[model samples]
Target chain A: MVEIIVCFKHVVDESELKVDRANNKINFEGAKTKISDDDKNAIEEAVRLKEKNGGTVIGLCLGKADARKSVKEALAMGCDKARLLSDPAFQDGDAIRTAYVLSQAIKRIGKYDIIITATGTTDVYSGIVGPALAEFLEIPQATFVSKVALAGDKVTLDRLMEEGVETVECDLPLLIAVAREINQPRFPTLIQIMSAGKKEVVEWKASDLGIEASTVGKNGSLVQVTSTQVPKSARKKILFEGSASESSERLADALLKEGVVN
Target chain B: MRFLVYSEDIDVELELVSAALKSQGSQVSIALVGDEDPKENSKTLSVAGVSSIFQIQDPALKDFLAEPVTSALEQISLEAKPDFVLIGATKRGKEVAPKLAVRLKLGCITDAQNLRFEDGHATADRVVWGGNATSTVSSKSGAVITIAPKANERAAGSSQPDVRVLNFETKTRSSKVVGKKAKDSAEVDIKNAQAVVSAGRGFKKKEDLILLNDLAGILHAAIGASRPLTSDLGWMPESRQVGLSGSTVKPKLYVAVGISGQIQHLTGMRDSKLIVAINNDKNAPIFQECDYGVVGDLYQVVPALTKALRAKTGR
Candidate 1:
């Protein structure tokens, strides 16, 4: 039986993300937590792949336990099993450490045919973890996947490219990181929600995974962020008080005055 | 203390990162991750005075996919153990750097405009919220820093990748590299271009961009615009927009036309070598910041400037 492990992160809401102008730190104060949009798409993709091809879907949630709920969301989405990896040490971790913990979890979960993930989290908008995990797992990966199908042991898929889309065939047990063009995300059903609620959330810590602290979290990190504050935004609201045509003309006039239209 | 400026085997990126780090007095090293032969990548990194270049080449790395690329870094970091690792804030770097940092258990500053090390620690200038604010952030612990794409303005100079080969057994999974797709930029590309001609909302419509493009073609410059040009109006893609929400650009000559120089937009193009502004409003922020200012209507003035430049440069 083919087993697939999906890595996902719960990030701050992108629509509500705020920056404190006093300092350049992103404001999570007004922001609520959300599954990284890409990860969410990945979760949906994994579920669809499993439902169609018949495989076990394992959800790997590696972040603060607060993100444990995120795994429940995954279980609701169709994951057979979910693991929540959280420790105080893992808080505010950079992407590398997060991937490390996830890798350890994957290692522990052993014997997987595929690992599926989303391209990136919307907040930081960093799309690094997918390929990083593929390398860590020693597997080949395709990014920006659109259409995917499995025949026998090989899978055929399409990638959206600059010039033209290309089709490639790869053996199974590969990694896939989805870009924005994948299928629209699926909404959970009543049955899925109920199942997810009952689904197990396996918890693991750094010690549980036998990952050395010196190489696994902030202590092992090489770069240090000395400060995080929001940037100061220009608060001026230039309202052209006039009709659309008037507004357009006035705006044009303003642009000329500013030397922007000249 | 040294800085490892990581890049995908791109020529322009190699030069920009090395130049920026070297100017900052950090012994810069490069880890060019790709399927290409390591020798060439190493040569590209070395010309900029990079002490050494590390390349992890496997058939798995060709597409610049995030997973394998990031894992390679884990091995590189453990071995090189540089004080700080920098990645360009491009699409690939955006995906890979954070994951690489997570796996390596390192701190990272993404889209940072500036970097400074004191007492062997990294201080970074990270602009967030469309450059509405500037946050001077330093990781209390180790970090994996990502320089915002096109945000660095340093000129590319003599550099070669001082090559080293680190064969890492990448642990990859289900993901596969189907193919790569590049986005078309409506404005001029400033990623590594020598000169740029950019406009803000003041241009009003896509119809006004012809003169901008014409001038750019004559000047051998790339065209760019404020975020609204691409992000909201859909005239251009986000990849070409210059602002906090869009791509950041650094060029030798940045011509701001009909641009009011909002902070968010300016943050992306503020690092240009020479800035010239042509706007009707003398009070626009761009006027104060630009090296030269011309007050006029772009519709008429741009064509005139284009002709004048054509004659001056004999293009």
Candidate 2:
């Protein structure tokens, strides 16, 4: 049977992300942590595919030890096994280092056919991990995948490409990053929750993983934090507070002046 | 000097980026993350003067899904350190970049069209409110910065660097991906095309597209549309849209049939080799920027244009 691993993260909730000017650090106090919305989709996709293919679904989470609470949710979601690599040292981990740590664990786990992930995370929504991880694994990758089904030796997928849907066929042991459109994420049933409670969650650390500090967290990261702000979009709404005919006429005129409606 | 770097990596695309720290006299190492084949893509990037290729190749790295991608990117950033990171200013990139910045204690510059290195740090130039005001922002935090990826040409030549593998561990949380469906479209991709014919909300109805297709067929160009033309009336998928919240196009020849070139929309196709605007209004914003403008009703002008093209090419 194939082994499929889904990497998940517990980050500061979006509504609570704030910048502390005094220290230039993110205030994590009282900040509720939850699995990233995009990561949830990744976990769910892995669970669904595992169920269909009869493969093992393993969940890997990185962050503080407190993140285990979030890891439990992955177990409840249908992951057969869950592993948490939480350490005080890995708390402020960056992407490149995170990839290295996770890749080593996957190699230790051994024997996998397919891996899936969500399009992006609510925090650090760089949307680069899917391709980066695929490159790390040295496998052919397909991004923006919305639909997937196992067809004999290859996985048939519908890629949410630019204009039209791409019906792609790739061999197994491949990487596919899923968009929100790819699957309707499923909630773990109560029975699954009870079973998950009994399931084991393995733990690892920076030293336990045999990683160097220069390549793990802050020092290992290639990019740094610049600034954060709400997307300030100024909408000069030409509110046509008139009848539809008047609005349509004004819109048409706007189009004509803008050269749209000729 | 300040360098506006573009990296699709999740973790490191922040505001307080300091690439100059590594190389005393070079631009910040930021550019689009292309294919992950190190020997092929990395060699190409090396020739372009990029210091490193922050590659994330987890087994799950295929699609550009937002959430998990954000999570994994956090992993990559923790590994390969760069000055500033930029993502494509598409829908997913816009949503993901700002959110990702927050996780890594970073900031973001939205919808940046161009990037340059300045002073002793990197400052990004982005339009504040759409196209109303252009602002140049500098970050003392030296945090990883995220900007909309520009149509940056790939640096010619190549260098092969060590391909570092990153594997991050995480908990499996419950979220369901139960169904999958694709937004259907019948048009060609505006980015990869050589020439394009686009429409805007001015077309009025679906039936008006016949004239557009005829003209496009004669010109040997594919069809595209502004955001409203496809989103409001559902004439096409969001992917075919050319404007803010859509794909950026730098085609050779772009024909605007019924489009009133709003700045948000114009930014997507502004780099076209030649722009032809067809609008009844001679003073339309599109006319100002277009290489050629025809002031006439599309009902008559379209057929005439098609006939002229057909006669000239004898197709």
Candidate 3:
């Protein structure tokens, strides 16, 4: 039987984020949180793999304690067990520190066949954690994976790249960072949501995972965010209100005058 | 400052070289991995700002697999000890940088832009929250960062860099490429296109995209689409998708037809020099972000615009 670990992120709902253009800052207060879109795809893929093969799917998350609510959602969708790596020391970790923490937790678990992750989180979109985790754990990784076919311990993956797709093969004990096109995430039934609370959920801290304080959190971050600002551009906001043909002619003339048209 | 730059594509490598050169008194080195002739590759890479070229000639690296490339680069970094490792942020580069960073225990940044050196530290800006805001980050210790493709100017100078070949072990490779399927050649390269006409869900049907095609054909522009047309409706290939998840375009002129202008879509094309939107709803968010907006049906506006442009330009 295969043992799968699906890693997901709890991030600010960027769609609902409010940018104060006047101040050139983002207002994060009162913002909501959810499982990132592509991470949900990772969770769905893990659940599907478990259903296909005789195996168990364990949900893993690294977030604040508030993330437990979202972690329950993973259980509702189908993780047999879950682990939440939440500690005050883990705050403000960059991709490197985050990957290190996850790798340590995986080592503590001591048994896993495949680790699934999103190509990148919707919030940061850095796309570093998966490959970094693979390095920290010393496993092979296939990123941007759109398809997966598992047979015994061998896994075939179709990786989507800018030019095309590459079909690859690797053994288990691998890391696969899935793309959005992999599969559609399913909604949990009401019963499933209710019963999800009964599943095993463990909250582990840095001390529990044997992670030294110097190796995580803002203190250990290699890259520091020195500043942040909203990218501002003043659009002309000119409106051409008329019949389609009239507006079309006017737009063509205006574009030609602007010299943007060749 | 010392910088190590590597990319699978020669052109992007040159751009990274140029970016590194932007910092005065900087020494740039490139690690080239492949079975190809290092002398031939170094001829193109040895620019004015570059100090040396490190070549790891191996057959296993010919296919652009991350495992082997990372291993080779790791080998070079151990010897070079450069303060900054700049990798081309292609699909392969993204995979390679993180693993390399973990191997070296260095911090890593992705999609780094506006790189500058300060007090022996490398600092750069990157887009976050899907282009809503920019974050300026810095790393005092050595770091691995992926440079977005075409993010910087190409390096130009008469100086030549010394080339050193090293033998690297590829025993770490755990996956193998069995086959590859190239995408259709018909798909336009929107990233390189000077003008683009993007479609959105406002189209009634798939065949109706002909209107957008006609407009783009006359303008000599590429065809781009919002995520729905490519990912959900299957009207176009994913390459034609212009959004946070798809290709980002900064063409001189961008025409959005029936697009509602979600932030995800806006993040990709907001950098275009001039933007125009045609939608039936005046309140569509696309109008807020466009330089010029027309409140009318795209079916009528698109064809009429095409006809007007065809007549005006005499194309």
Candidate 4:
């Protein structure tokens, strides 16, 4: 049976959070967290692959202790088993360090045919963790995958690019970063949610993975957030009030006068 | 001081890096990786601010695979030890930067805008929570950074610089490109166009895009759409979708019709010079971000705008 692992992130739901303009900080206090929008598609794709090809789907998550909640959610979404890597040492870990921890967990989890990750996380959206993880695992990887097909031990991917689509082929044990366009993620039903509580969730701390604390978290992060601020727009924001045609005429006149249009 | 700018193609992002490096009084060297001839490629790429060009050619580097490109760049960096490296934040660049950072044991930042050198460290801003907020980050010395496309002004053309061909072999064994296909040409080039007319979910039917297309025609603007219009409804090609998952466009004018201004969509086009939003919902989030907003039915407002533009331009 094909063994597929889907790596996902539990992120602060940005819609529910409020930014404190005074300090330029996002207020996550009392904010709800959920699986990142793109990770949902990753989990759904893994589940679909398992259903079609007769495989076991395992969900992997790396975050704080709160990430245990994600393991249950992934189980509800049809993941057979889930693994969580939680430690205070993982807080604010950059992409490179995060990939290191994930690759280690994957190694501990044993053999796997394929690993899937979202193109990016909703909170950070750097889109670098998957590729970095692939590097750590020393495995082949395809990013921005919009379509996937598996046959035997070969995987075919249609990678999305700026100008065109490139179809790539790689052997099994491949990692793919799926874009949101791949598939519509399914929400779990009440029965699935209730049964998810019974599934196995293996938890691992930094020491359990044999990773040194100095190399796993903020101390290891190379990039530093010196400061943050709301982007100030310099637009004039001139409002034109009139009928549809009249407003259109006025807007056209303003644009022409500004030399934006001839 | 030395700076290295690497881009597979000679594009605005490369030019912007050249300009940025030049302004900082840093000697700039560009690295071009592909099958293109060094002498010929330098002719078009050795614009105003570049002092030298390093052309890296290998059959293995032909595809957009990140591993090979990262390996090649790593080899170059090991020898040159450039103080800074700037990569354009394309799909391939984002995949390669972190891996390169991990390999080189250097800091890396992605999607940096308004980058400047401060106290020997590279500082820049990036949007978070889609586009609702921005964060300013500074990287340690010897950091690899990916500059967002259209983030800076393009450098003016100047005399060609000297070209130096580099001997490097790509050692990528895992991934292989099977085939490649170009998107349809009828799709608008939002990246390069000066103006764009974008559609959103407010577009009830595929045929309604005609109104947007007509407006685009009058303004000679490219037609772009929000994600739902392209990915969900299939009303338009994916190439023209504007969002975090789609094309990031920075046109002189961006006219959004029926788009509710989701953060994902805003991140792609928020940098536009002038934004005009026409939506029936007065309380739509787009109104908060747009420079000019018209709260009315797109069916009526778009046609009127098209007519007004035609009357003024005599097109």
Q: Model-by-model lDDT, in order?
A: 0.67, 0.59, 0.88, 0.83
- List residue ranges in candidate 2 displaced over 4 A: A11-34, A149-158, A163-172, A234-262, B1-114, B118-185, B189-315
Question: Residue-wise lDDT of candidate 2 within B1-315, one digit each (tens)?
Answer: 333344444222332133233335654443323224434443444543445555545434344444455666666566655345555554446445544565565544454434455443445555432232344555433444444433443344344434454553432221223234454443345566777889887687887887788877755677888877765577766667786435677776788877877665776887776677777665556765676556666666667666555554467
TM-score of each model's B chain?
A: 0.72, 0.75, 0.91, 0.88
Estimate the Cα RMSD of every predicted model relative to the unseen true structure: 7.6, 12.3, 1.9, 2.4
Which residue runs does candidate 4 get wrong by more than 4 Å? A19-25, A241-246, B16-25, B47-52, B154-164, B310-315
Give candidate 3 misplaced runs (Cα > 4 Å). A234-239, B188-192, B281-289
Q: Which candidate is the best by DockQ?
A: 3
The local distance difference test score of model 3 is 0.88
Give the per-residue lDDT of model 4 (tens digit) for B17-89.
5645654678777777875555666677767778777778887787757888888888777666777788888
Which of 1 and 4 is ahead in DockQ? 4
The model with the greater TM-score, 2 or 4, is 4
**True-vs-predicted CA distance for residue B71, candidate 1, Å:** 9.1
All candidates in order of TM-score, best leading: 3, 4, 1, 2
Clashing pairs in 3: none
Query: What C-alpha lDDT, on a 0 to 100 scale, does residue A139 get in candidate 4?
Result: 84
Candidate 1 lDDT tens digits, A1-262: 5578888887666456664434545666866777876688788888888888897999998878688778888888889989888877776555556666787889998888778887666555445567667656766677666677888788887764433355666887788777545666788898888878787788998889888767766665554444555544232224333232333344334433544332
DockQ for every model comes to: 0.18, 0.03, 0.72, 0.67
